[model samples]
Target chain A: MNYSNLFRIAIRALIRNKLRAFLTMLGIIIGVASVIAMLAIGEGSKQKMRGQISSMGTNMVMVMPNFQRRGGVSLGASSSMALKYTDVIALRNEAVDVGAVSPEIRASGQIIYSNKNTQTTIYGVSEEYLSIRKLEVLSGRVFNANETRSMAKVCILGQTVVENLFGKGADPVGLSIRIKNLPFLVIGVLKDKGESGMGQDQDDLILAPYTTVQRRLAAIDYINGIYASALSEEKSPAAIVEVEEILRRTHKLKESTENDFRVMSQSELLKTITSITDIMTYLLGAIAGISLLVGGIGIMNIMFVSVTERTREIGLRMSIGGRGKDIMKQFLAESIILSILGGVMGVVFGYLLARLAGSLMSSQAIVKTQSVVLAFIVCFVIGVFFGWYPARKAANLNPIDALRYE
Target chain B: MNTIIEIRNLRKDYHVGEVTVHALRGIDLKITEGEFVAIMGASGSGKSTMLNILGCLDKPTAGDYLLDGINVSSMEKDAIARLRNQKLGFVFQAYNLLARTTALENVELPLFYNPKVRARDRREAAIRALEAVGLTDRMHHMPNQLSGGQQQRVAIARSLVNDPVLILADEPTGNLDTRTSFEIMELFQNLNEKGRTIVYVTHEPDIAKFATRNVMFRDGKIYRESIVTERLNAKEILETLPVEVIEEFD
Candidate 1:
C-alpha cells in the first residue's frame, strides 16, 4: 500500500479508540517532560553557581599564611609566611598588569559608639585593599600610605555596622569608635556586598590601617593573608604566576620542596564550584532517564495488548491481500506519531514547569533548546524501537487460523 | 472448451504432533470455463481442504495446480494473492461483510485489491456489481442494517466487482432460512446463466439440485459424480417445493 492509504488506516484506527490511544501516549508525555525539566534544572543551577562565583571579584588570588601548629598549640610561621608588607610593596613595584595587592591583618573586637554597640571582624590593610576587594567608600575615603606609616587611628565601617552603630540613614565618616579598647576614627562607610555562594556575609566587617591592627589589636607584626587583584578576570593566570614567583623568592624556599602556602586564583575556585553543580545535574537527569525507560516499556506493553485485541481484524486484512509489511508499517507509524505528539506537548509543559520554579526563585528559568530537541528525537526512536515486535507479530499471523479464531 | 482450472494428482496433509492427516487424497480434476458445479460432503470429508486449495489460499502437499494455464501450486504467497485478486472471487457461508463499512465500500474492496482497477473505475464497477445483485437501493447502508440474505447479496456483489471468471462459494446460505436460501440460490443461478462460472458446496439436497453438475466426497475422495440434465430452477424450486428441505436426492 502507498503511504497515504496506510496513514489513513492508522489514523482511523487510532481515532476509533481515542481513549486507549491517549492513554498509550501518556507514558511518552511524562518521559519527554521529565527529560526536559530535569536538564533545564541542571543547566539552571550551573549558571547560578557561575554567577555567584563571578560576584566575588574575579582574577583575585587568596594568599594565606602557612601557619604551623605543634601539639595543638599555635606557632606562627614567620619564615614560611612570605606574603608580607615587603612582598606587597615589591608586587606594586615589579609586577606588570598587577592592579593591587594588600596584606590583610584581621582581629575580632567590639566597637562602641554612643548607645549602639556591635561585635564584628576588623580587617586592617593598606589603602589599595578597598579597590582590590571591590569595596566602595560610600561616604569617606580610604586611609593613605601616610596613615599606615603613622599608624593613624582611622577605620572603615561596612554598611551593616554603620546601620547598627549610628542608626539608619546616618553617616559615620570622621567619627571615633573604640575597637578592642583602642580609640579609632571612622574614615569611611563601605558599600554593601551581598552574600557569597557559601552563604557567608560580605557586608559585616570593619577596615583599618594594617599597622593599627598590629600595634593595638594583635600586638604583633605578622599578617594573616594577602589579597591581590589582577587587571582583569581573564588575566588571572599571569597574575598568579607573578605572585608565586615573588612569594617563592621572598620565602627563599629551596628547589624540590613543596611550597609552604596554597595560592588559589578566583578561576580555580569557580571551576570547583561548577563541577559540583554539574555532577548534581547529571545525577538528577539520570534519575529522570530511568523513568523514561520505564515509560518506553509501558508503550510496549500497551502495543502488545492492542495486537492481541485486533487479531481478527489482522486476519481479515491479510485474507483481503494485506501483506505482513503493510500491517507492520501501519502499526509502527501509529506508535511513532503518538510518541512524537506527546514529546512536543511535553516540551511545552516542561518549559512551563521550569519557568514556574525559576519564578519562585526570583530568577529567570533557562530551557536548553538542545535538551528539548533531544527529548523529541528520543521519543520517536523509542516508539519505533519498542513498537516493532508487536506489529511484527500481528503481521506474521496465519490468515486461515486467525480467521477461524474466536 | 478450454480448461480454466486443472489439478493433477493433488494431495494435502496436516501434522498434529507426529500424526500426519492426509486431507486430500491424490485428486485429479479439470473444470471447464463457465461450468456450474456443486461439491457436497459430510463433516470431516475434506471438502473444505479442497476448497482452500482451489482458492489458492493453501498449497497441496505434492501436485501441479494451474490457473489460466499458469502453475500456481508452488508460487509464493504474494504471487498467489495477485493471481487470486485478478482471477478468483470468494463467497463464504458467513457473508463476511465488513461490519463498519457500507454495502458499496464492501463491494469495492476486491477491486481495490486489483491494481488494474483505477479509483474511479473501481467505483463505477462496484456500483454495477451492486446493481446486478439487486442491492442498488441499499448500497449506502451498513452490513448490520441489512438482512442475512441482503448481506449475502452484498458479498456476491463484492465477488463480482473484479469480474473474476471463477466464483467459489463455500456453504453459502448455510445460515439462512429456506426461503432466503432459495433467493440467494436464484441470484447465483441468474449469475451462472449469464455465463459466469460458479463452484458451490452444500449438504442440503434442495440446494444441490440448483447446480447443473454434482460431485460428492467421502473419506477425503470423490465417491459419486453426476450430471443433472433437467436441473431444478432455484426460483421455481422455492415456489413449488415444501418449506422443509426434502432429503431424497441423497
Candidate 2:
C-alpha cells in the first residue's frame, strides 16, 4: 500500500476517537515541555553567572590570606592578616605577568553627613584599585601618593552609600563625611554597578587609600587582601602562578611549608559555578526523560487496546488482500503521527512557559534550538519503540480466527 | 462452460488438544462460471469451512483446489491474499460494512489493496459498483443510516468493485426479514444473470430455492447434488409480498 493511503487511514482512525488520542498525547506533551523549561532555566542561570564574572573583569585575580592557627586552634581565613603591603609591592616588582597591583583592606562603620548616617563597608586601596576592579569614578578624583603619605582622611563613596548618606542627584564630591567619629573627605562618587549573580549588592561600599584606613581608622599596619589585574584574559592563569610565588617568597616560606596566601582567578570561579549548574541541568533533564518513558508506555498501552478492538477490521482488510506488513504499517503510522503531533505542540507550549518563567523570575530563560530538535528525535524513537509490539501482534493474527472473534 | 472452481479430496481437520476434529472429509466439487450454486447444510455440517477454504481465507489439509486454472491450495499466505484480491469477492452475513464509513468508501476498500488501481480509477470503479446495486443516491450514507437490505446492497457493491471471477457469500441473507432477504436474492439473481459466478452457503431451503442447483452437505460429506427442476424468481416472489412501510420521518 502507498504511504499516503496508510497515513490517511491512520488519521481517520485517530479522529474517530478524538478524546482518547489526545489523552494519549498528553503524556508526551508534558514530558517534552518539562524538559525544555528545565533546561532553559538551568542554561539561563549559567549564562547569568558568566555575565556576572566577566563584568567583574575576567583578567582580575584576588589574593587572600590562608587560615591562621593560634595555639593549635584554627581560625577562619578572614582573621588571617598575613597579606601585607610589601607582598603587593613584591608582586608588582617580580611578577612579569602581573599588570597592576593594589593592597586592599576592609572595615564596616557608620558614615555621617549632616545627621543622615548610614552603615556601609569601607574598602581601603591604592590609586590602581579602580583600574584593577574595573570601577569608574563618576566625579572628582582618587587619592594620590601625597595623600597616602600624609595619611589623609580621603574616601570615594559608592552609588548605594552616596544615595543613603546624601540623597539622589546630590554630588558629594569635595564634601566631608564622618567615618566612626573620624571626619573624611569624599573626593568622588563611583558609578553604579548593579547586583551580582549571587544577588549581593555591588554598590554598597566606600573606597579609600589603604594607608589611610590602616593607620588612621583601624590603627593597623598590615593589609587584609590584595587585588591584581593581568594584561589580558588569557594571561590570568600565569599571573596567578607569578603572584603566588611572589607571596611565597615574601612570607619566607620553606619548600615543605604550606603557603599562607591563596590566589584565585575569575575564570576559575566561573568553571566551579558552571560545573555545578551543568550537574543540575543534567539531573533535571534525566527526571524529565523518565516522564517521556512513561509517556511511551502510555502509547504502547493504548495501541494494544486499539489492536484488540479492531481485530475484525484487521481480518476484513486481510481478506481484501492487505498483507501482514500493511497492517503493521497502518498501526505504526498511527502512533508516530500521534507522537509527532504531540511533539510539535509541546515545543510551542515549552517556549511559552519558558518565557513566562523568565518574566516571573526576572532572568533570561533561553529555549535552545538544539533542545527542541533533541526532544523531537526522542519522540520519534519512542513512537517506533512502543508501537512495534502492538503492530507485530496485529500483523501476526490469523485471518480466520480474527474474523471469527467477537 | 469454463470451470471457475475445482476441488478434489478436500480435507480440513481442527486440532483441539489431543483430538483432531474432521471438519471436511474427502469432498469433491466443481463449479462453472455463470452458475448460481447453493451449498445447503446446518451448523457444524462443514458448509462454513468449505466456504472459507473456497474464499482463500483458509488452507485445505489435503486437496487439489484450483481457481481460474491456478492451483492455490498449498500457496503461501501473502500469495493467497493477492489471489483472493485478484479473483475472489466476499459477502458476509453481517454485511461487514465499516460502520462509520460512507457507502462509497466502503466499496472502495478492496481497491486500496489492489496496487494496479490508481486513485481516480478506484473512485470511478467504486461509483460504478454502487450504481450496479442501485445505491447511487445513498452512496454517501453510513452503514448505520441505511436499512438491512440497503446495507447488504452496499456489501454487494463492495464485492462487485473488484470485478473478481467468483463471489463467495456465506449466509448473505441470514439476518434479513423475508421481504428484505428476497430483495437481496433478487439483486444476486440479477447479477448472476449478467454472467457472474456465485457460490452461496445457506441452511434455509426456502432461501436456497433461487439457485439453479443445490448441493446438500451432511456430516462433512456431500450427500446429494442436483439441478433445480423449477427454480423460484426472487423478483416475482418479492412482488407478491406486502409492501414494507418504513418510518417516513427518517
Candidate 3:
C-alpha cells in the first residue's frame, strides 16, 4: 500500500476515537514541555553567572604569596612576605602575554573627613591598577606614574567609601581624608561596581600608590601581592606560566624547592562555575527524561488496547487484501502521528513556560534550537519503540480467528 | 466456461484440546466463470470452513487448491493476500461496512490496498460500483444512516470496487427482511447475467433456488451436487408479494 493512503487510514482511525487519542498524547505533551523548560532555565542561570563574573574584570590574574611557616607555626597568605616588589617588576618586564601589572599593599584604617569617619580597607597599588582591574575614574583623574614614583600621598575613593565619608553623590576629588592618622589627598572617585558573586561589597575600598602606602602609612618595604591582566582570556594560562617562571627565578628558588608564590587566573574561577552549572543542567534533564519515559509507556498501553479493540477490523482488512506489513504500518503511523503532534504543542508551551519562569526569577531564559530538535527526535524514537510490540501483535493475528471474534 | 476455482482432496483439521476435529474431508469441487453456485449446510457441516479456505483466510492441512489456475494452497501468507486482492471479492452476512464513513469511502477501502489504483481512479471506480448496486444517490450517507439492505448493498459495492475475478457472499441477505432479501438477490442475478462469477453460502433452501447450481454439505463432506433445472426469478417473486399501504389522514 502507498504511504499516503496508509497515513490517511491511520488518521481516520485515530479521529474515530478523538477523546482516547488526545488522552494518550497528554503524557507526551507534559513530558516534552518540562524537559525544554528545565534545560532553558539551567542554561539561563549559567549565562547569568558568566556575565556577573566578566563584569568584575576581563582576563585579570592575581599573584599571591603562599602560606609561610615560622617556628613550625603556619601564617596565612596575608602574613607571608614571600612576594616582593622585585618579583612584580620582573613579571611586568619579562612576560610577553602580560598586558599590565600592578603591585598591591593592603591596610585597614579609619578614614575621617569633616567629622564623618568610616572603617574600610585601603589598597596601595601602582598607576596600572586602573586598566588592569577595569576600574574607571568617574569624576577626576587617576594618580599618574610620576606621583606613584614620588611617593605622593594621593588616594582614590570607591563609591561606598565616598558615600560613607562625605554623604551620597559626593565627589571627593581634591579632598583630604586621614588614613592611619596620616593625611591623604583624594585624586579620583571610581564608578560604582555593585557586589561580587561572593556577596562582598565591591565599592567599599580605597586606592593609593604602593610607594606611598609602603613608605608612609604602613611603613612596609616588601609588597603583599601583584595583579596582572593578559592580552586576552585565551592567553591567560600562558601568562600565568610566564609569571610563575619569572617569579620563581626572581625569588632565587631552586628547581627542587617548592615555589612560595601562586598565580591564579579568572579562567579557573570560570571553570569552577561552569562545572557546577553543567551538573545542574544534567540533573534537571535527567529528571525530566523520566517523565518522557513514562509517556512512552503510556503510548504502549494505549496501542495495546487499540489493537485489541480493532481485531475485527484488522481481520476484515486482511481478508480484503492487506498484508501484515500494511497492518503494522497503519498502527505504527497512528502512534507516530500522536507523538509528533504532541511534540509540537509541547515545544510552544515549553517556550512560554521558560519565558514565564525567567521573568519570575529575574534571569534570562534562552531556548536553544538544538534542545528543541533533540526533544523532537527523542519523541519520535519513543513512538517507534513503544509502538513496535503492539503493532507486531496486530500484524501477527490470525485472520480466521480475528474475523470470528466478537 | 473458464474454470475460476478448482479443488482436489481438500482437507482441514482443527485441534481442540488434543482432539482432532475434521473441518473439511477430501472435498473436490470445481466452479467455473459466470456460474452462480450456492453452498448449503448446517452450522457444523463445515461449509463455513470451505468458504474460509476458498477465501484464502485459512490454509488446508492437506490439499491442492487452485484459484484462477494458481496453486493458492502452496502460496505464503503475503502472496495469498496479493492474489486475494487481485482475484477475490467478499460480502459478509453482517454487512461489514466501516462505521462512521460515507458509502463512497467504504467502497473506496479496497482500492486503497491496490497499489496500481490511483487516488482519482479509485474515487471514480467506487462511484461506478456504488451505481451498480443502485446506491448512487446515497453514496455520501454514513453506514449508520443507511438501512440494513442499503448497507449490504454498500458492502456489495465495496466487494466489487476492486473488479475481482470471483465474488464470494456468505449469507449476504441473512440480516435483511424478505422483501430486501429478494431485492438483493435480484441485484446478484443482474450481476451474474453480466458474466460475473459468484459463490454463495447459506442454510435456507428457499434462498438456494436463486442460484444456477447448488452444492450440499453433510459432516465435512459434499453430500449432493446438482444443477438447478428450474431457477427462481427474485424480481418476479418480489412483484407477487403483498405490499403494505399507508393510509393518508390528511
Candidate 4:
C-alpha cells in the first residue's frame, strides 16, 4: 500500500482508542520536553558565566605574593608581602605587552560621613587602576599622577560604598569621609558594577593613592598585589610573562631560584570556569537522555500490546492479501506518527517551560535550533528502533492461528 | 467452466511437540468457476485444514496445487499473499470486521491490498459489493451496530469487493440463528447464480444441502463425493421462515 493509505489506516487505528494512544504519547512528550529544557538551562548558565567573567575586565592580569615556606610550615600568600611599588614601576617602565600597571594595598576600616558609618575595604591604587579594573567615574575626577606622587588624601568611592555612607543614588563626590580618623576627600563616585559570578559585590570598595594608603592607613612598605592589563585580550598571556619577568628582576631573584610571586591572567580564569560549566551541561544532558530512552521503551511496550490486542484484525488483513511487510509498515507508521507528534508538541512545551523556569530563577534560558532538531531526529530514530520488533512480531504471526484467536 | 482450484494428493501434518498428527493424509480436489461446493466433516476431519490450504493461508506438507492456472504449491509466502489478494475472497464465521470501522470501510478492505484499484474505484467497488449483498442501507453502520445477519452480509460484501475468482466461507452462518442462516445462504446462492464461484465448510447436513455439490471428509480423506439430487433453495427456505418482529417502545 502507498504511504498515505498506510498512514490513514494507522491513524484510524489510533483514533479508535484515543485514551490509550494519548497515554502512550505522554512518555515521549515528557522525555523530549525535559531534554530541551535541561539543555537550554545549561546553555543559558554557561553564557551567563562567560558574560560575567568578561565584564570584570578584558585582558586583565593579577600578580600576587606567593606563599612563603618557613621550616616546612607555609605562610599564606596574603602574609608574604612580596609584591612592591618598585616591581609595579619596573613592569610599567620595562614591559611592552602590559598596557597599564597599578599596585594595590588593601586596608579595611570604618568610614564615617556625618552620622552614617560603614565598614569597608580601601584599595590603594594609582590613577591607571580605574582603566585596568574596568571601573568608570560617574562624577568628579580620578586621582591623577600629581595626586599619587604627593600622597594626596583623595579617594574614589564605589557605588556600594557611596550607598552605605550617604544612601542610594547619592553622589558623594567632593565630600570628605573619615577613614582611620583621617579625613579623605571623595574625588569621584564610581559607576555600579553589580555582582561577580562568585556572588561577591564588585562595587563595595574605595580607591585611593597607593602612597597615601602605605604611609597613613596600613603603615606598610611593600604593596599587597599588582593589577595589570594587556594592550589586547590576545596578549594577556604575554603580558603575564612580561610582568613576572619584570618583578623577578626587581626582586633580584637569581635564575635558579623560584619566583616569589604568582602571575595569573583573566583568560586562564575564564577557561577554568568554562570547563566547569561545560561538564555541568553534559551531566544535565545525560540525565535527560535516560528519560528519552525510557520513553522509547514505553513506545515498544505499547506497540507490543497493540499487536497482541489486534491479532484477529491482523489475520483478516493478511487473508485479504496484506504481505508481512505491509502489516509491519502499518504498525510502524502508527508509532512513528505518535512519537513525531509528541516531539513537535514537546519542542513547544520545552520552550515555554524553559522560559517559565528562567523567570523563576531570574536568568535567561536560551533554546538553540540545534537542540530542537536533535530532539526531532532522536524522536524519529526512537520510533523506528522501538517499533521494529513489535511490528515484526505481528507480521510473523500465522494467519490461521491469528484468525482462530479468541 | 474454467478450473479455479486443482489439488493433487494434498497432505498436511501437525507436529505437537514430539507427536506428529496427520491432519490431512492425502486429498485430491477440483473446483471450477461458477460452481458452489460444500466440504462437510466432523471436528478433526481435516476439512478446516483443506480450507486453509485452498485459501493459501497454509502450505501443505506435500502437494501440487494450481489456483486459477498458477502453480501455488511452491510459491513464497509473499507471492501467495499477492495471489490471494488478486484471485481469492474469504468470509469467516466470526464476521472478522474491524471494530469501530464502518461496514463500508470493512467491505473496502479487500480492495485496499489490490494496487490496481485506485482509492475512488475501491470505494465504488465496495459500494457495488454491498449492494449485491443487499446491505447498501446499513453500509455506514459499524459491525457492532448491525444485526448478526447484516454483519455476515457485510462480510460477504467484503469478499466480493476484489471480484476474485473464488470465495471461501468457513461456517459463514455458524454464529447466526436458523432464519438468519437461511438468509445468509440465500445471499450466497444469489451471488453464485451470477457466475461467482463459492466454497464453504460446514458440518450441518442441512447447510451443506444448499450447495450444488457436497464432499464429506473422514479420517483425513474424502469419504464421499456426490451431487445434490434434491438441492435446498435457501431463498425458498427463508421465505417459509417466520418474519422477525420489531418491538416498539413507548
Q: Clashes in each model (backbone N, CA, C under 3 Å)?
A: 0, 0, 0, 0
CAPRI band for model 4:
high
Worst 10 residues of 3 chain B by lDDT: B241-250
B122-156 per-residue lDDT for model 1 (tens digits): 77999999999998999889888888889999989
The digit string of per-residue lDDT tens for model 3 on A182-247 reads 899998999998777656898999999999888887787888889999889999999999899888
> Which lDDT tens digits does candidate 3 get at residues B27-114?
9999999999999999999999999999999999998999999999779889988877878999999888888888999899889899
Return the top candidate by DockQ: 4
Give the C-alpha miss distance for residue A369 in model 1, angstroms. Answer: 2.5
lDDT at position B167, candidate 1: 90
* Residue A169 shift from truth in candidate 2, angstroms: 5.8
lDDT of 4 by residue, B1-250 (tens): 7999999998999999999999998888898889999999999999999999899999999988999999898799899999889889999999999999999999988777888899778788989999999988887898888888889999998988888999999999999989889989999899899999999999999999999999999989999999999999998887787788944221
Off by over 4 Å in 1: A66-82, A109-122, A125-195, A199-220, A232-234, A361-363, B1-4, B32-38, B84-215, B225-250
By DockQ rank, best first, the candidates go: 4, 2, 3, 1
Candidate 1 docking category? acceptable
Query: Using lDDT as the measure, what is the rank order of every candidate, best first?
Result: 4, 3, 2, 1
**What residue pairs clash in candidate 4, if any at all?**
none
DockQ for each candidate?
A: 0.27, 0.74, 0.70, 0.82
Q: Which scores greater on lDDT, model 1 or model 2?
A: 2
TM-score of candidate 4 on Cα atoms, chains taken together:
0.95
lDDT of 2 by residue, B31-105 (tens): 999999999988999999999999988898998999999999768878888887879899999888877888999
Q: Model 4: chain B TM-score vs. truth?
A: 0.97
Task: Give lDDT tens digits, candidate 2, residues A1-406.
Answer: 8988889778878887899999999999989888888889888888988898788888999998888777998876444878778898898888899899999988888889997999998988999999988899999888899998888999999999988988986799989999988999999989888898789999999998888888877777788889999889899999998888888888999999887878999878888989999999889889988988898899999999999999998988888788899889999998998888888888888888888998898888989999999999999999999999999999999988888889
Per-residue lDDT value at A302 in model 3: 98
